[model samples]
Target: VEVRPNPGGKGFVTALGGKWGWSGSGRAFVPQLVMYAGPADYHNKPKKIDADIETYLVGHGFNGFHTIVCCRWFDINEERSTRIKGPAPNPDPRTFEALELLIGKVHSAGGMVHIWAWGDESRRQTPVRLGGKNGLADLRLQRYIAARLGPIPGWTMGYGYDLDEWVARKDLDIWHRHMHAQLGWPHLLGGRSVGPNRYRRGAKFPQIYEGLDYSGYEQHQPTYEAYVAALAARPKRPSFSEDRFRVRKPSPYPKKDYTEELTRRGLWHSTMAGGVANIWGKYVRRGQKTTFQPYDHPEWIKTNALFFKGRFVKDMIRDNQITDGVCLRRPTGEHFVFYKEGAESIRMDLSKMPGSRRAVAVDALKPYREIDLGELRPENQTWKAPQKSDWAVAVGEFRK
Candidate 1:
């Protein structure tokens, strides 16, 4: 069904507000973190997923989080009569019930949810075959799924169409539009996993596609320095990281090593780089402990619950101006200049900044004790990191 624009000639709009807009905070751009949970978590065993969310990722400091709900293709594709039947196109009632429950929990927790489905298979870096043989049948399936699940508030849907490179296909865009017109929620497209290649692929898309609202790239455990640089140079659009967590060969880094500080650091690391961090919940495999349980890791709980107070460093620096270079500033009067880890100090030129600004050094590890660099005037400021260990200094009009 080709969806025509509304009477005003504008494209489809959702109850969530404009198709593309900043999050509630007004400053944060499409702030979210995606995570995948198995069927059990959403089924009768809802307590575990709920507990992990309430206890670990939400409240206190972690606000405005979005987790993508991923499921096995077979789970939603199975038929009734409690039998393995052919072409069960409609969403199973049991699965819909579970999804309804899960969506409610996500809303109550002050977070957004997303349904993840793979696009029709094509020869690519990672081929995903979701919509089977008949294209029209697949469209009907998607339409039925959308009509049933569309009204769920504060959620988005994404089709894994591109993986690790640019495919330049129009079918993906068509699918996105169909979903948007049917579901009334903006859909996301694009994925180029790995460092600069991800952003490179995203840049080539033709400027205007009616329904495309956001794009994402997956970075498998990229260093902070590299992540920040790539995001700064990428296209100026709302971006999300499909995968940002560290993973080893056999299993993901265990809880102790994948500490809370590390998790929070990774999140900010991506956000500061102008991208959203998808917190991979399925971290390690330890005999029935296959998925991410933030409570299990002491550091994950401790750091996430309290560290990185509301826009601490971000409030000081300019948005989208964060670069590895010595200086960062915005016309709004925010300023920042910091040294990477292992750097003693950097000679910064402050002539461009206004006079009488507050300068403070931030230790990424111990955020509580922010050392003040005293009243800084516009000049060649030679600032040193007090107490070392990866320090950053922000000189700007201080906000309370």
Candidate 2:
């Protein structure tokens, strides 16, 4: 399944009076954040493995897939823990090999693989058990396996750092050279539990509260300051709406202003909204009583994904001002100024500009043609306007 970009693509929103290239908003795909569930594998080897999930994803116009390879290796938190079965301190030869095969397949489909390190694994510089092996040391094992696997292409690197921690570690300046960094993998950080949707009263479990203690916005100030100090200074981050979602339908908490903010910022932090089970238990299952929306009813994910995807299209269109009727212009180097009668938004490829090589970048992925997000409907009753509450403020501050 080799996929090449559609040259100039069928322009989603052409300047000339062309119908929107895509049906609704005219965007290709939404970014993904998938977690692994089901079989715990130190060496999970399914002879007749079913990749219907991947195939299904392709049918929906997804640009890519993010597979969780070599994680849940260890879940180290204050909660009582059960050691996963298998050998430790030594790598599971089978699991290591399977990861290679998985990476190969994903890359072939033009999908990206994101090897995750969760829980204490991110914070701990030490190795522990993963299945039969310890993660601290096993990461090295993964590296060794990767050495054999070589660079298969189409993969990302997600470490178990909260958004703030990324700033903190960046401040310390050793992140790039650390053992984890040694893999030279791309970064995709996540580790937030208990979204407002999950909690009836903002937050339910006290442990969720504890996790937030470290995830707070002010906590990230030092992290940001550290970034400022180490990076030798730069402009503040661009404005973009940022949000975290919860499952069980009818998003218990939806904030509007921040929603706009995430839209304005052109950035976000999205969670598939389940522990490991989201991926393994339901989505990968067939005809089961799905507890989640998208998995239980594919239509839900399709509609909702459209809602989110529409925003991105809106952002890019706003920023790029690729207008025929709207009339577009790029007044300066990187700024894509939109103008019809009045101005709207500016699009910038930060990396395209000088001194921005190391900065966060904006990119457009090729289309795949599969639907991962379910149906779109009015926000659940619990959904709230973004700016009307502190949700955005809290999230804005979360990473500082």
Candidate 3:
């Protein structure tokens, strides 16, 4: 498939050629997390695992997954312990077979795959490890990967997680050159930049790498302002949040620094700010034997419904001046989407939006229950919610 940046530079389009086309109106890609622990330990039930993951992604409105191609904990030399010898040409045939199977399943489900060469652990796989001495090994590895997986539809290639920490710009350019020469099909290439921390460090990948089709950020605690700023800073290509903090219930960590609510808010915030993609960080149990099950969260499903099913997100742009809260409106003023964090009435200036319109409000906490605001006139109006909590409002021509 030919997947290129949309004309607006806000999302992607796959209409040029191929069996796969854009699925939803959201115009954004949201992928789930899948960390493979090499063939030795995790290849026993590959088919069943692939089926479960496919079901979950299709059922939950996710279009793809952010997958680590290497073994889990590959950064730790002691933990990896000869499990992975080097980059690419993973000696075992079963590994490539399993990957191909998974990719095939994803394509059949109408989803894409974001392939990460490494995991969050970045220090181990450097240019030297990828064969930087003569660059032949690196070129061969790129050729090996492209030859095997390049023909597949609905997938993109990424350098790795936390790529800025270890790989240099010159090395990445060389790798890109090799991959570009090898792959005959059209595909996007990107890399995950360093994440936010106490130091408030911003990612540099978008500024440094000129060949990236989409810019990636690992924002742990994302906000509307931060995403807007980031989007404004890089206006040429689409932006994706590879990691926006994992969503695990029942407090997996002691402090519970991240929560599902935060993740949900981040999803909407990022989307409203023009981010083309975001990954849901739901991890599998860590051990030699890796296992995964579909999450039973309906909130994510509702959010996706609101974006793709309810609204024409591809035609909207961030315009906060239209309302007191976060607003996204079509350039022609036919539709308006507002998101407010607290439960309160929003004052929207709709005088310019002419004609009678229909408005619907959904509480962010309980999005399934939508409260219809009935028909509204084209004038400045104040819309109230059913109760107090985070809410999302959609006002425009109603479709049956």
Best by TM-score: 3
lDDT of residue 78 for candidate 3:
26
Q: Global lDDT for candidate 1?
A: 0.46
By descending lDDT, how would the candidates be arranged?
3, 1, 2
Model 3 residue runs over 4 Å out of place are 1-51, 71-81, 84-92, 120-127, 195-206, 248-257, 284-296, 310-312, 398-400
Lowest lDDT sum, 10 consecutive residues, model 3, at: 11-20
lDDT (tens digit, per residue) of candidate 3 on 297-340: 65555554455453634546788887888887888888888878
lDDT of 1 by residue, 227-339 (tens): 55544444444454555353422544353133444564565465444444354443556775545434334333233324333333322333332333334344555455444
What candidate 2 gets wrong by more than 4 Å, as runs, is 1-30, 33-50, 54-56, 66-88, 120-139, 145-150, 161-175, 179-246, 249-400
Model 3 residue 101 CA deviation (Å) reads 2.0
Please give the lDDT score for candidate 2.
0.28
Q: lDDT per prediction? A: 0.46, 0.28, 0.59
Off by over 4 Å in 1: 1-25, 29-34, 44-46, 59-84, 119-137, 161-168, 187-211, 223-234, 247-268, 286-289, 295-328, 335-339, 346-348, 367-369, 372-374, 397-400
Residue pairs in clash, model 3: none
